[model samples]
Target chain A: MGFSISVEGGQGEATIKLVGELDAAAAPQFKEAIEKLAVDKPQRLILHMDQLEFMASAGLRVLIFARQKMGADVSLYVIGSRGPVLNTLKMSGFHHSVYLQDTYAPE
Target chain B: MDKLTLPAVLASLAELRRYAREAAAAAGIEEERSYQLQLAVDEIATNIISYGYKDAGPMAQIVIGGEITADVLIITLEDHAPAFDPRTRQMPDDDELSKPLEERTIGGLGIYLAMEGVDRFDYRREGERNLNIFEMRRRNG
Candidate 1:
């Protein structure tokens, strides 16, 4: 499957839901979404990735871009990532950089 | 063994991954290992298309072939773009991987995962072709 991304937000929180395969071809779109979200400077960024079946190094680069773009003060949460998507995050130790949860339970 | 040749472009990655996954399954590779193999192939193939074929012109092609031996499943990626060896790419060290988000660099993560995900990864250059070999040990059940 090709990649698709959507953003939902209100106030200080924003959630980006990513679906389908995220390869080099789709990384730019994701990076663009992050760029748009960074403009608002939300306090919290949540990535919903349950349906994101595959993620390559390109996707990882964008995750880094999103984190840096969001800055250190913002909290980033990754929810429902599984299979190869979860494996990529865990293998690259990216799971440590963000809050990983089965569901979005904001503190 | 089944071999396929496709344009060395980003769009061909999905079909390449599907080919790898199906080959792994036919070779009796488990689900997790199959995904790893797929990732490994995608990473190297991406590098080949993105870097190797950067200025090699429009007709550049990436050839992917799968071989199932008695004990191992091997997938080979060949490209005529350049003789770049993915193993030579510097991977992120432990210290680098543990760094804070803002301080970390994303370079080499793909090659790192590609090498680490598979049981064995090898690279070689034959004449003008760059061959990346990814291998996984078949289960003995």
Candidate 2:
């Protein structure tokens, strides 16, 4: 299947849930969400990707874009990414740019 | 061994994936070697579409072939793009990943990862086309 994204507010942060395959086809939608979040300028951004099964290099590019659009002061969290999706991040060395956790803890 | 041409778009990734899987299986590639070959092909094919031929026109085509000899999987990809050797590109430094996205470089990491994933990688500029050959053997072998 293709990909989908859902953004919601949680406590003091904004959480974006990504589902399905994140590839070149899904990058535009992903980019739009990050741009919208940049307007709100949340203190933290949490990406829930437990259901994300795959990620292409284009998807990784969007993740990099999100990191830049959100700015350095904003904390970015990626939760529950596994399998090929997580390997893409680890292989590209993106696992270091964001905080990765099995579960998001409300602070 | 099989060959097919699809538009060099992100939409074509599924086609590439299937090609890699079927080709590896037909070659009787081991599980670990199959996975590594798949990853390497994905990275290279994606790079070809994204960077090698970023323009719109006759979509760049990929020729994939594989064989198993003595428990080793040998896959080769031939494409008509500029003479760019992915292997010669430098890998990202340990600290490069932590930098801000804007400060970080965009390309090169995929090629680096592909190199690391396979047991052997070789590239050559064959006349008008770029030829890349990758090999992977059973880890315990």
Docking class of 1: high
Question: Quick one: best lDDT, which candidate?
Answer: 1
Assess each model's interface with DockQ, reporting 2 decimals per model.
0.80, 0.50
Give a tens-digit lDDT track for model 1, residues B38-120: 98899899888888889878898999999999999999999997678887889999888877778888889999999988989
- Please compute and give the TM-score of the first chain of candidate 2 against the native first chain: 0.91
Candidate 1 clashing pairs? none
Across all candidates, the chain A TM-score values are 0.94, 0.91
Model 1: how far residue B138 lies from native, Å? 1.2
Per-residue CA lDDT of model 2 for B1-141, tens digit only, reads 656767767677766766777777776666555666676787888787777887646656777766667766677777787777887777787678666565787777777767877889999888988888888764445
Question: Would you list the C-alpha lDDT of every candidate in the order shown?
Answer: 0.89, 0.76
- Tell me each candidate's TM-score: 0.96, 0.85
TM-score of predicted model 1?
A: 0.96
